[model samples]
Target: MATRCCIAGGGPAGLVLGYLLARSGVPVVVLEKHDDFLRDFRGDTIHPSTLQVLEDVGLLDRFLRLPHQEIGELTADVFGEVVVMADFRHLPAPRPFLVLVPQWDFLDFIADEARKFPHFELRMGARVTRVLEEDGRVAGVEVSQRGDTQEIRAGLVVAADGRHTTVRTSAGLPTTDYGAPIDVLWFHLPRTPEDPSRTGGTMRPGSMLVTLNRDTYWQCAYVIPKGSLEALRARGLPAFRRSVAEISGFLGDVVDRIASWDDVKLLSVQVSRMPRWWRDGLLCIGDAAHAMSPIGGVGINLAIQDAVAAANLLAAPLREGRLLPAHLEAVQRRREWPTRVTQRMQIALQDALLSPLLARTDVPAGVPLPVRLLQRLPLLRRLPARAIGMGVRPERVRLPPAG
Candidate 1:
């Protein structure tokens, strides 16, 4: 099989880029190893900037019709004090709030939209084993599907295949691991009407939990020191349930819903990025280019932005068959700054806040200084709102949809 562009991984980046490219008349195929997008505990925060991209594509109304929760303000409970972190109500975008929806629904929505264009194709259960290289440049990919291996050649091969990317590694791109001091154990507990209406984080003396209000149930992340999963498991599931309940008392008996360790999924947090994100005929974006710390819940939104930028810059060239190595470099140039800035902030937060908090045994006293400041100067809250909602450098839909 051959196409103008072949994207590996049908996550936010690949699917969005495929949709935009195909919508602009470029033949694109997205290879997803998974048969479906129903994975649990993925990043589900769609910030204002991503909503603007959806609006630009004229799918905002349709997307909002899907089941989702809008968060206009971000509040966190630090040491039992609820502090307002960000106010997204004032962001300069089509939607000034964070949209929380299961990532599968989001991916499926984009996949469904992309399927409307004849130039687009999504291959499920297709794993990209390696990049097909010709004369030191990526020609396409070697895909493994149902005991069959096939080569799909393309003018451009995109590696959007999450943090553990085979394409980037096969292409021999050097990546710098900034490293993270934490990992997250994720699980869900039933929610009741008495629960907090807004999504927020709960941080106590030696524990931190982030809860996303998913209407019926709360999607929770229990943060732990990196490489401590075995220690946690040895501590036993009952002990783990108590720790979560100790952090968020409102859950009451629902914490007991975590029947066993199998109900919990461990996310080994990583923060890393490549200095250069592309080669001659290959480009890397999203988690493949940079694995973000789950600090601000910005990974998915950032990946979508990368997709928008990639589509805007490469669609026309790929369609016209004038694609150049420099065109790939342009995508890195456009996205690298935001990636650097966001990663830097996440690293600082991890090192200064989370690492210490996770290691400490004493109870945290008083509202955190930054939280106090945001509360004192109500207008100051908008700064973080803008940073998280709009991001460092947000992309818009520039390539018009193909008629």
Candidate 2:
């Protein structure tokens, strides 16, 4: 009998895993609760690192053809001084910059690709309610949609669900929370004539803006402490706009344009890590395994990386025989360190930026002078690209392949 792999949550992570496994001729099924891939304000920035992965999987051309914007530079303004963190010009790829594309469109493209494989099956509107365990090992999943429920028996079960993962929770997996002090108030404002330079869109000072297609509207982000959204809203639209204006340094009449509460939406920020990403016959990837705060624009990329890593390691064993506990353990060992390091780095950066006291006065011991000196070097400016592209190696972890 062939090994059956059941993947929960058909987001980028699950879909990509299914695509790779299906292409390799492994039987796979993806269960997604949503009937369609249309979610608002998801992580849309495709980082340079993720672009390389897409290229590796032969989806680069398709991804680039989508309606998107090329992000050239990551600029930060502290007080009145400006700092450019990463310059895409120095990166060695044909397309060196991040691409700002809607998450729904990207997922749709991946799903379409997955459809080409006969072994890949995507069941929309299917929500996994419980993980089926037999003799303390994952056997399959119990899922429901509308009014119907069914048990899916599989050799392997993959949970790609978001932060509040039902599988992870049901399995009683341990989790570590790296608390994020700040949250994002995401909103869109009309592109005004006064800020022509920014009509191209820029991460100005303390705020972030992505100019969505010909600069009709800007996807703007403002930082606030976690759990402060209701308080901010209670103060009303004028106060909300004023808060945004103050944080962003009163960007050229753009603040005045946000007239109503409906214009802004608030999202909480969190970074979480599972103690162990896998157990007997079960594995978790993407946000289910590790969730990073949306600070460095790495969450989506990391999720894709997780999917790729899982597919590369498990597909062969899954194709030949029964899925083993050792295989899942190997996957966990390979993935844990990179996820931990990345999440830590994100938290550190978040602390430095979101906290006013830290941003202004609490410079780390060796950072100030070197940071200043490095800013002068053109080569050093592209460190962010290097960090994303080649900094972490997943192969460092040793794991045995199934015989």
Candidate 3:
């Protein structure tokens, strides 16, 4: 099969790019290795930047109709005290709040919309094994599906296949690992009507737990030092359950739902980015290009922004067959700064806050001074709100839809 663009990975970046390209009359196919988008613990927070893109594409109203919870502000419980972190209500956008919906629902919505255009195709369970190259340019992909492998040539190939991306590695792209001091163990617990409505987490000396309110349940991420899962397991599940209950006392005995280690999913957090994101007919976006820390839950939004920028810069060129190496470089040039800025913030937070917190052995009596200042000066909260909500250099949809 042949098309204008073949995108590896059907996550936020690839699907959104495919949808936009197809809208612009570019034949595009998105290959997802998974049969379904039901994987647990994916980033689900849709920020204001992404919401603005949806509005520009005229899909905001339809997207709002989906079942999702909105968060106006981000708050965290530090040493048994609630600290207001980011206030999203004042963000400059049509939807000035963060939307929390299951990632599968969001992807399905994009896939459904893209199907309206004749040029769009989505192949689920299609795993990309290698890049097809010719004359020193990436030509297409060798994809495996249902016990058969075949070549699908394209004008361009996109490696949106995430951090452990086979496509990017196959093409021999080099990545710079900034390194993370922590990993997260994720699990779910029952949420009740009396449970806190605001989405946030709890932090204590030597331990931290992030709790995202998923309407029916709380999706919890328990942060631990890197390479320490074995030590934690040796301490036993009952001991782990006690630690969780102690930090977020409101959960009470509900923590018992974590029946065994199997109930907890390990997320080995990695923060790294490729010095160069593309070469010839290939480009890498989202986690494939830069793997982010789960600090502000901004990974999904960043990936979506990359897609919007890529589509904006490359759609017309690909449709007219005037694409060049310079066009691909423009995408990296447009997005690389934001990726670097965001990763810097995440790494600083990891080193200055998380690393020290996890290493401490004493219980603190009060919230940190920074938390107190933010709580005291309500106006200061918007700084963080703007950073998390708007991001740096948010992209707008500029490609006019082709009839």
Q: Per-model C-alpha lDDT, please?
A: 0.93, 0.73, 0.94
* Sequence-dependent TM-score of model 3: 0.99
TM-score order, best first, reads: 3, 1, 2
lDDT of 2 by residue, 145-164 (tens): 88898999889989998888
Q: Which scores better on lDDT, 1 or 2?
A: 1
Candidate 1 local lDDT, residue 182:
98
TM-score (C-alpha) between model 1 and the true structure: 0.98
Tell me each candidate's TM-score.
0.98, 0.87, 0.99
Ranking by lDDT: 3, 1, 2
Candidate 3 root-mean-square deviation in Å: 0.9
What shift in Å separates residue 370 of candidate 3 from its native position after superposition?
1.6
Question: Which regions of candidate 1 are displaced past 4 Å?
Answer: none
Error of 3 at 242 (Å): 0.5
Write model 3 residue lDDT over 80-105, tens digit each, in one string: 78889999898899999999999999
Q: Which residue segments of model 2 deviate by more than 4 Å?
A: 1-3, 92-94, 192-214, 246-262, 357-371, 389-391, 394-403
Error of 3 at 247 (Å): 0.5
